[model samples]
Target: MLKKVLIANRGEIACRIVRTGHRLGVATVAVYSDADRDALHVRLAGEAVHIGPSPAVESYLRSDRIIDAALRSGADAIHPGYGFLSENPDFAGAVAAAGLRFIGPPATAIRAMGLKDAAKALMEKAGVPVVPGYHGADQDPDFLLGEAGRIGFPVLVKARAGGGGKGMRRVETAAAFKEALASARREALAAFGDASCLIEKYIAHPRHIEIQVFGDDHGNVVHLFERDCSAQRRHQKVIEEAPAPGMPEAMRLAMGEAAVKAAQAIGYSGAGTIEFIADASEGLKADRFWFMEMNTRLQVEHPVTEAITGVDLVEWQLRVASGEPLPKRQEELSIDGWAFEARLYAEDAERGFLPATGMLAHLDLPDDLARVDSGVRAGDRISPYYDPMIAKIITHGPDRTAALSRLSDALAQVRAAGVTTNAAFLRRLTIQPDFAEGRPDTGLIDRHLTELTMVHAAPPEVAALAALSFSGTLAARKTNDPWALLSGFRLWSGASDFILLEHRGQPLPVSFLSKGEGNYRVLLEGRDVDLRISSSPDAFRVEVDGRTSTLHEVHDGKATTVFRDGESWHFTLADPLAGEDEAAAAGDRIVAPIPGLVKLLHVAPGAAVSRGEALAVMEAMKMELALPAPRDGRIAEVLVSQGEQVLEGAVLLTLEVEDG
Candidate 1:
């Protein structure tokens, strides 16, 4: 086994590698950029090295800096954890040249499968089925347009270099092809440093399934079965599971065999995934799947595979890199149970899944009900410099129904505060009819987006709890002190109090009259609610209208959040002295929704634009967002130039004021 290894990554994957390295008695070294100086991964490793600045281009993506860090730390091997330079063939070669072991496949194999277009062509030559598309090298726009027409409408334009839904667009007609192509090319260049793309026939009602395969230097390879990732949004996988639901035995066997063949064809070693896109319009069939691409490194969803097979994929990678033979033969591997993994991101599902940045004031994930893999702790900030993934929740059981039930229960138990998250959205997906019935496609989320993203209004009880917290009633109850109670005394009746709170931009006035010990009559929005409330330091026992429940509440000075059954309702204390600013609320200025670089400016000063017309593009968190005109208007002035970085709410341009 390698004595010392350097993790050439950050975030959860880097922290994940460090744990395994420690368990195996191997010393680990972690490299971090300026933004991650105090990150959890840096504190977990035995040795640490500073790389560069916050941006990935000047730090994690720099092969020379990573190699130097590994050498300086005296690490015998370097583990490229999933992203960053994990799949870069040149980086792999560089590590080997520095006399350090690269804990991955040979550079030749990575080079062979690095580009989607070339990988598809190679798969075809190896007799593995591939999707029909134009994998040619012609860069002319007219030529690509002709190819898309020949392939038929509803074609997919995908970046040839990288994955993760970046630089990918589905064009439904020839009229939209040029714009989509341009957008895809620009995003592709920004992400992968390669602007080339390939056209593929979009498989309507498709299901994404990938096989986890491992190989050793001894020319032995074995498959760990399949993971179904059909639950997606914006062409990105949202939920993943092992031993695909509704997978036929024969079909599984065929896919497993094809996956092994793809690995053998490239002389590959270490951990890799063979992704396939299946036409599930007719249900899963043995002959309906085609090779999509090969990920030449560990995948983000490898835990589900590990849960079912009872194997540690990272350990396997380490052993194989240390010149060991395969741990188990193909026949020796078997699936033990069903597993599901839901990605919890720091994103607002109600706001078109926009990435959010904030300090995690309170973070709690259920450990007994499921496995929670995370790198950030309470007080950690979710910045815009890296992926917005907060954690991945994985659950396993003896059957699909049981496993899915556990997932739902686990999601209900999650509690996060101080940032918008998709925990509620993920829980909704778990119960989505088609998904719950084991019939999910890539378009499942889009088809049910309206219902899935619908923000549930906080109930009267929830609002009551927030009011109690805001008025210090809950805190006073915990102390059992008469003087601590802030309820104003009335000579004739009982102590009464009135507080104002805001929920979803609407002000709510709550009034309550204290009856006696732990009892009150609360009025909110003209509805009266009788409540008996008692509190401990961590939780409150509230009986509202004959229903009893326990709830957790947190007040961070500005807002109060009440959590119950994994769902949360946040309410801010409304100030009576503050008045609404109509000017700021009006749609006269275009502002950046999040901190990002201005990638393009579609309109200039005095340009007349229609409502919903794209005016500018902002790139942040590795995704491009096109800002549209809020109404029919003419541009008055452009405040920022392309390539300039702006903070959230920074005004980019203004619309001319028109007289009515």
Candidate 2:
């Protein structure tokens, strides 16, 4: 066995590798960038080395630095845990040059499947089915336009070097073909440093299925079945499950055999996945699926496959890289149950899943029945420089239905503050009618976006608890006046003290009555509650309906008052007696959404555009978002240009819309 293994990655994946390393009795080494000095993965590993600066190019993507880290740590092998340098074939060669084992496929395998166009050619020769479209090398604009016409309308322009939907466009009309090609190429260049593209028939209502194929040094390869990852947003998977529901065994065997053959064709070793795009228009027939590219490393959703198959892919990777034979034969490998994996993101699902950044005030998850693989604990910061995925929640049971139920229960009880998240959104998706039926396709989320994206309404009991325990600057009045003490409390008679506070955008109030000084029974919601207060320093706790709510705030007489529920809620102790308003500013230029490189700016200044027109496109958080104009307008200013890296909220372009 390899004595020490260096993980060339960050976040949960690095942490995940360390976990298996410990189990296998292999010392794990972790390499981190400056931004990840205090990251969880660094602490989890047996040893850690600082690679370089935060920008991935300076650190994680630097093959030399990764090799140096492995050498310095005395690790016998390096595991490029997905993304960064996982699929970079040259990096594999560099690692080999350093005389260290790369715990993945040989360099040949990565190179073979590196580019979509090249891979399609190879797969076709290997007798694997490929999508019908243009995968030629002609990049001339006129040639691409001709190809689009040849392929017919409703074709997909995909980056020859792209994945995660970063550099892909589905052009539904001939008129939009040229624009889509330019946009796709720009993102392709920005994301993969390759502007080459391919055109394919866009299979409507497709199911994104990928097979988990594993191989050992002995030329033995077997597949662990398929994962239905059709539930996506912008070509990025949000939820994935194993043994795709309603999947025909004949199709499974065919796809599995193809995946194994594809791996063996390139002399593949270790854990890799072969992704296939299947046309589900007719409900998952055997003949409709075609090769969609391959992820040449352990996948993010590997745990779901592991849960159902009772196999540890990481252990297999380590075992294979250590010159071990196949752990199990093809006949021995079989699925036992169903599993589901939900990607927990630190994003506002309601706000178009906008990546959110903040301190994770509290992070606690349920037991392992709902296995959570997370990189950060409470008080960790969600950085803007990396993927916004906070954790992966995996569940397994006898069937898909039970697995989904466990996922729902696990999500609801996870309490988090300081940033908005998709926890509620995920919880809602679990109960969705279509989702419960296990018939998820790539467009499932988009079709039910409005319902799935709704923000959850706070429960009345939680609201009651929040209102009763109020805080803030207790008003500027009664600094020296005795009546100031009466502000939050009522007198001896049956009366009420109204307190106003703001939570989200709504105003809420709580009423209470005073029984005595420093110690009194306050009338709360038709019931008298015991309130103990220290006159010198005011502090109290209110227990109601079997729940305890803590109150923390300064009694500032009367002015601005702040209170805490799950988060802080502030109120004006004194009524403003008047309201405030501001003039509406024009909403222009679909903002850059997030910090990333500008892929394409579709409209120039002074150009006329229509409502819902594609104005620009940006690549961020490893996905591409096309910014569309909300109304007909004349392009006023394109604040950015292609290939420019920008910050979040920086204007990409502006438009002059006529206000009626």
Candidate 1 has a TM-score of 0.94
**What lDDT tens digits, residue by residue, belong to model 1 across residues 1-660?**
999999999888898899999999989999999988899999999989999998888999999999999998899999999888998899999999999999999899999998999999999998889988899899788999999999999999999998889899999999999999999999899888999999999999899999999999999999999999999988789999998988999999999999999999999999999999999888899999999999999999999999999998999999998999989999999999899999999988987999888789998888999998888988998877889999999999999889999999999888888988899899999998899999988999999999988878887778888988888777777775667764565688788888899886778999988887788899988899998887777888889878988888888878888988767788998778775465444588899998888999999899999999999999887677899999998999999999898988899999998776
**lDDT score, candidate 1:** 0.91
TM-score, one value per model? 0.94, 0.81
True-structure RMSD, every candidate: 2.5, 6.9
Q: For candidate 1, what is the total of clashing residue pairs?
A: 1
Per-model lDDT = 0.91, 0.78
Off by over 4 Å in 1: 138-154, 171-195, 485-487, 580-587, 601-615, 629-641, 654-660
lDDT of 2 by residue, 236-327 (tens): 88889998988999899999989988888888898999999999878887888999898899999999999988998999999999999978
For residue 98, what is the lDDT in candidate 1?
A: 98
